[model samples]
Target chain A: MPLIDEILDLAGYRREDLYVCLGCKICSSICVLNEIGIEANPRNFIINLIMEKEELRRDPLLKYCTGCYACTFFCPWEIKVPDMVRAARAALLPSHPFEQAFSSSLELFGRVYEPYLLFRLLPYFFRKGYLRLLVKGLPSFRLSLPKRVKTEGIFDREKK
Target chain B: MRYAYYPGCSLKGSAKGLDEGVKKVFSALGDELVEIPDWNCCGAFEFGEKERILALSQANIRKGREVSSEIIAPCPACLKNLREAADSSVSVLHPLEVFSEASFWDRLPMKRDLGGRPFTPYYGCILLRPREFALRVRDPMEEIITRLGGKVVSSQVKAQCCGGNLFFKELEVSERLAKKVWEGASGDIVTFCPLCHLVLKTFSEKGRRVFYLTDLILYVMGEREFL
Candidate 1:
C-alpha cells in the first residue's frame, strides 16, 4: 500500500489531491477561458472525476483548457486544475487527435514544434482559417531545428 | 550572483530576443549566467504526461546541477517545469527576482526617458501563480516601469493567459483569446514569459509592439531597436 501511494504520488496528480476539492466553483468563475466564452467548468469536471464518471473523460469541453492554472491559483482547496486536466487528458488523448499529434511532436522533437505541428494539423488548420499560419511556417526550417532538444530518458521507471 | 541558465527551446528560437535581453540585463547587473551544458528540453506540452514532463525536467535539472547550485530559467513555462523537478538541493529562479534584488536598484542609472504612456505589464498565466512554484516578486514590473519613468497601464487581462497553449492547438480560439489580451491591453503589451511574448508578438496587429520584461530592461539601458 505504501509503495502504491509512492508510485501514484510520483506519477503526478494523486487521487488524494482530488479528495480536497470542496466544489466551491471559484476555479470555474475565475477561469480565463470563461472570459473567452468557453465554459470551462473545472469544478464539475473535478467533481465528476471524484465520482468516477466515465462520461466526463470523453467530454469535448475538457479540450478547451488553455492549461492556464488561473483556476488552481484561485482554488480554495489548492487542487491543481492543470494536473487534473492532465490526468483526464491522458485518458482523453486517443480521441483528441490534435492533442495527440502535438504530444507526439514533443515525443519526437521535444519542443512546441512548428513545422510538424503544421504538417500534422494541416486539415485542422485549414478548417480553422489559419492557412496563413501554415504558409508562414512553411518557409521557416531554420526555426524548427531548435525545437529538437533530445531529453535523454534518465528516469526509466514507468507506472503500471 | 551566478546561476546556471536554461534557455528553454522557445527562448532559443521565437523568443530569442528574450534570451539576448536576459544576457544583456544580467551582465549590466554584474551577475554571471552560465548555460547548462547539454540541458534538455523542459517540457511545455500541455497534454504531455506529467511523469514524462517531470522526467524531462529532471534530466535538465541534472544537467543544470553540473553547472551551478542555482538555476535560472528565463521563460515562465521552463521555470515552472524545472522547479517542479528540483528539490531542496537546487534552487530555480526567474528574472523577476532580479528586479527585487538590491543589486538591480543600486546599479540602475537615473530613469531613462523612453517617452511613453503607462506600459501594460503582462505577467501571463503562470509566472506568479499556483502559489508554491511562483516567483516572489509581485508587481515588480510595475515598480520597475514606474521607476524608469514609465507608468503601469492597468488592464483586466494583465495577468491572463495570452492563449499560449491554444495558439498551437486551437488556432481560432487562440486568436480569440489573443484578441482579448491585445484589446484589453493599453498601448504596448509588456510580457514576462516567452509563450505570452510569442503569442502576443506574432498576433498583435496595428504595430502594437510586445516587449518582454527583459527587453524593457534593455530599452531603459538604451538599446532602442530590439525587433
Candidate 2:
C-alpha cells in the first residue's frame, strides 16, 4: 500500500492536504507541547512524514502532539498540523479502539454515547490502574446519553 | 421566535444544564425552542479526516433539514461541524446569537445582576478558525453578559485553543493548554462552548470557576435549579 493511502486509512485526511504543508517552523514556535516541555516540533514532524521517514514518525514523543490547532491559527500556509499529527498517531497505534467506538456509535445511533463508552472503557483502565482517570471520569459516568432516534413520526415538539 | 434546537450529545449528557437553561431562557422570552427530531451528534470533535467528518456532518444536516429551516445549536463544536455541512437551505445559529437578537432582549422579563463577578467569554478555536474568513465570528456572549448585568474582563486567550479536542488523546497537553487559558483570563469565567467549559473545569485550579453561558443566564434569571 502507498504511504498516503496508509495515512488516509489510518487518519482519514487526504494526501493532497499533506502536499500543501510548507516546511515552516511557525507551528513549532506556537505549539503548546513544545512550549510546555515536549520536544516533538510540528514542522519537523511534517517534514519527516513528507520524507517518508517512518522511524521518526514512530518516536514516542510524537504522542504528545495534541490537535489543539493553535498552530493552525498562525500557519501562513494554513496547514492543519493537528490533523496530520492525529493521522500520524493513528498510524502508530496497532488498533484505534476509541476511534472504532466513535465510528460504531455514530453508525448505530448517529451520536457518540460518551457515558456508555466510559462504562465500557472503565474496566480496561482499571486493570491498567489509571486511578486518576477513573477519579476524573467517574462524575461524567452519571450523565445520560441522548435518547435514540425515533423515525416514522413528526418532530418531537415541546408545548409551553 | 421558534427555532429547531440542536442540543448535540454534550447538551444531553455532560452539559445538560446548558440545554435546560438555554431552553428556559428562550421560553421566558416567549420564543419556542424545538428539538431537531432524530438529530444525531455533530461528530463531537473534528475527525481531521475529511470524508468521515463530512459524511457525519452531512448526515446531521439531512436530519436537521427534516425538522425546521432555522437550526439553533448551543454547543460550539456542534455548531462548527453542522455549519461546515449545512447548505443555504437552513440557517444555523448559536443560542448566544439568538439571545443577542434585539427582539429577544427587548422581550426579556427582568435582568438579574450577578453581583459583579468578572467574566471573560472564551470562543475556542474550531468555531472561528480555518474557515474564519467566511464564518464572520460574532461576540454575542459579551452582549448577553452585560445585559444580565455582569462585568466583562478582557481576555488574552479569547481566540486561543482550549485543547478540548486533545483531551482524550493527550490529556497532559490538554491540561497545559487549559491552564494556559486560565492563566490569561483569571476570575470566574464563562464560556460559550461546552467543550471549553468541560476542559476548563476539568483542569481548572481551586481559585477558578468555569461556567457554561447558559448557567450564567439561568442564574441571572433567578431559576437556581442548576446542577
Candidate 3:
C-alpha cells in the first residue's frame, strides 16, 4: 500500500490538507538530520507519499524518527507529520519485534505490582520528609492496579 | 481540586528539589495530589526507540485508569510521554496546569522577590504549546521574577528538548542542541521539568544560570510567608 494512503486510512488526513502544503522545506531545514547523519527529509517523504510511491515508505530514514514532533511543530500548516508516521508505523507493527516486546511489558508491569508493594517501595526512593509531604498532600486512600494479567518479554538486554 | 500525580524517577533522586517545591505549592493551593500506586517507570527516553506509541501510551493509560481524577505529571518527559501515548479516555495535565487554574491560582502564595530579582518562568518542551498552562504561570512567575530583580523573557527556543537523554547515544548532537537552547535565552532559564534541568545543568559552561521551577518557588516562599 502507498504510505500516504495507508496513513490517511488510519489518521483520516485528507488530500486537501496535502494541497495546502507548499513544500517550502522548512520542516527539513530545521530538522536535526545532520546530527544523526541521516538524510531524512519530511518534505520529500510527504511529497513521495503523495505521489503514490512505495519506496518512500521503505526508506531506512523512517526508522530514525524520534517522534519528537519537531517537524509538525515547525510546519506552517500545522500538519501532523508525527501522527502520519505513527499511522504508517501501526501498519508495519508486526515486523518490529522490539516494539512488540515493549508494549507487552507495560501491561505486565501493571498486573504484577500491587498497591502494597508500590507504597512501601515508593517512599524509600523519595526523601523521608518529601515522602511524608507527599502522603500529606495526597488523598486519604490508596489506588491499586489490577490483580492478574499476562506478562511478556520487554527486556531482552539489561541496562548497563 | 484533586489530581493523579506521577512523579517520575528523577523526583526521588537528582530532582528531589522539584518534589519539595511542588509539595509546598500544592499544599498551599489546597489541592490533593494522589500518587498513582504501583506506577512503573514511564520508560523515559528509551521507550521511544523501543515502541513509539504503545510503550509510551500504556504507562499513561495504566496510571490514568488507576486514578479517578486527572493525572498531574510534574516531569515534562512524563507529561509528554503520557500525552503522546494516544490514549483518549484519560486526561493528562501538567502540575502547573492544575496550579494555574483560576480556582487554585489564588490559593498559591505569590512572593515578590528572590535575592532582590524577579523569577523567570521556563516552560520547557511539553508545556510550551499548551497555551492554557503557560498563561497560568505567566502572571505569578512574572510577579515573583520582578520582585527578585530579575526579568522574564519568553523564548521560542524554551520549548526545545534539552537533549540530555540523547547525550549517551549522541553526545555531540546533544551538545549542539543544548548550545542552541543556551544561545536562544537571555538571563537564566527556569523550568519545571527535572530532565530539562539535568540537561541544561550538564551543558551549562559556567555563569549560565538554570533553575528548576521549584527552586525559585521555594526561594520566594521561604523568603516571604509560609502557606
Candidate 2 docking classification: acceptable
Is 1 or 3 the stronger prediction by DockQ?
Answer: 1
lDDT of 3 by residue, B69-100 (tens): 47777876667667766355777776665655
Measure candidate 1: CA RMSD: 3.9
State the weakest 10-residue window (summed lDDT) of model 3 chain A.
A133-142
- If the candidates were sorted by their lDDT against the true structure, best first, what order would they fall in? 1, 2, 3
Task: Give lDDT tens digits, candidate 1, residues A1-160.
Answer: 4422332343375777777888788988888778877777888877766666766756544677887788888888777767656555665455455665656666666555655666787887777767765343221233545344546753233212
TM-scores for every predicted model? 0.86, 0.83, 0.64
What local lDDT score does residue B166 receive in model 2, on the 0 to 100 scale? 66
Q: Looking at model 1 chain A, which ten-residue stretch has the lowest summed lDDT?
A: A134-143
lDDT of candidate 1 over B1-227, digit per residue (tens): 78899988667665677788888888877889999876766657553357777788888888888889989888888888888889888999888886688678788654465565678988887787778888777788887787777778865677777777877667767878888888888889888777776667667787687777776777778865542
User: Candidate 2, DockQ to 2 decimals?
Assistant: 0.31
Query: Residue by residue across A1-160, what tens digits does model 3's lDDT show?
Result: 6556666676557777777888898878766554446677888777876886777667543555544556666788867665566566666544343334334444545321324433444544253333443342222222433343222233333222
Computed on alpha carbons, the lDDT of every model, listed in order, comes to 0.72, 0.68, 0.58
> Quick one: how many clashes does candidate 1 have?
0
